[model samples]
Target chain A: GAGVSQSPRYKVAKRGQDVALRCDPISGHVSLFWYQQALGQGPEFLTYFQNEAQLDKSGLPSDRFFAERPEGSVSTLKIQRTQQEDSAVYLCASSRPPGEKLFFGSGTQLSVL
Target chain B: EDKVVQSPLSLVVHEGDTVTLNCSYEVTNFRSLLWYKQEKKAPTFLFMLTSSGIEKKSGRLSSILDKKELSSILNITATQTGDSAIYLCAAKGYGGATNKLIFGTGTLLAVQP
Candidate 1:
């Protein structure tokens, strides 16, 4: 599919382990977003980027949660020293500039033990 | 804080029944209201309502936004078993440099055969 692509569909890591989740947005889609969805809950915004510049990350739970879009096309969300509470599905979505609708990837289900 | 609230956390209905979902929100610089359906992994975009009073429809699904009341409603008529999924309501807000979406917990709908 030409939609957003997420890697490591599922991840299991012991507490204190660091994890990295990747997302490849649709070609030429300028706006990228990261969201966290816990079981039985809607996705919560985590960060936003436009062409390599991360403009917003106010929704990040802590400093340990860091995201970056180095080239503005691909993004990575890195969680350092993971906690059990961090278990959730991390979703990636992209939209064209002046974005009104979003295209989402299947998401990475991260499980921290 | 920007937030979206949805009513009837869960619902079960016969295949031929009609159902209505409600969503209300409060946010700074509200840009749009969006709906998505999540079956298992990816959340598929259903509708994006920006202008008030104009209802957007697609087959059995229709949605309307009300800026005066800061709310929206989604109606699905003669729903099928395939309509069983978690329906998400999100409010897009523009504050600072981010145009992020704040989502409600979601309404779980089960259309029984």
Candidate 2:
């Protein structure tokens, strides 16, 4: 079975640029999540989606960060006006439902200069 | 604030040794605890413990959750160099309000050959 997958393993962007990271969750998974992992630290929550609806975005550090999962399978995390502080690996994970085990993607390592 | 905390931010052990990792949390709507292992890329799921399923074991790795204490412990027997990675703990909140996974700082394990 295919696990979660992410595109563009690495990305380099200048400050104030916009970046979009994509994630493909396993088929039929109802819950999707995005996280930001800074160097030498664990991943921080970003947002979550159930089905095609965006349920939570409280974890988004600022308004510049937005994510969407239309049709409930493919998701994208877009960060507008990138900053050096946002330089980190963006991770995506999916689970059948809340409280279930989550499967994670390889992640996109974004380096903002 | 709701948070997950992991102890022993880093550990260095030789192959065949035993190791233990800890995770504690403080959240209003406690649901479940999860464990993950990561090496350079995305995190791999290790275990998910809820109120009913408190203890889980897979080969050399085992984990237990103490709901009363709001904590969990992961034990690895006969640690191997391949087990060297960062161990993360996350807590899921209850209710239908978006399954946000709050994460701990993580423990970096370096198993020496």
Model 2 agreement with the true structure over B1-113: per-residue lDDT tens digits? 88999999999999999999999999777888999999888899899888643579999999999988889999999999999999999998777567777889999999999
Top model by lDDT, which number? Answer: 1
Worst 10 residues of 1 chain B by lDDT: B92-101
How would you encode candidate 2's per-residue C-alpha lDDT over A1-113 as one tens digit per residue? 38899988999999999999999998888999999999988888888898888888888999999899887889999999999999999999898964378889999999999
Q: B1-113, model 1: which lDDT tens digit per residue?
A: 78899988999999999999999999889999999999998999999999999999999999999999999999999999999999999998775787788899999999999
Q: Score the docking of each candidate (DockQ).
A: 0.87, 0.79
Q: What is the DockQ of candidate 1?
A: 0.87
lDDT of 2: 0.90
Write candidate 1's Cα lDDT for A1-113 as tens digits.
Answer: 48899999999999999999999999999999999999998999999998899988888999999999998788999999999999999999999988778899999999999
lDDT of 2 at A81: 98
The fnat of each candidate, in order, is 0.85, 0.87
Q: What is the Cα-based TM-score of model 2? A: 0.95
lDDT of 1: 0.94
Span of ten consecutive residues with least summed lDDT in model 2 chain A? A94-103
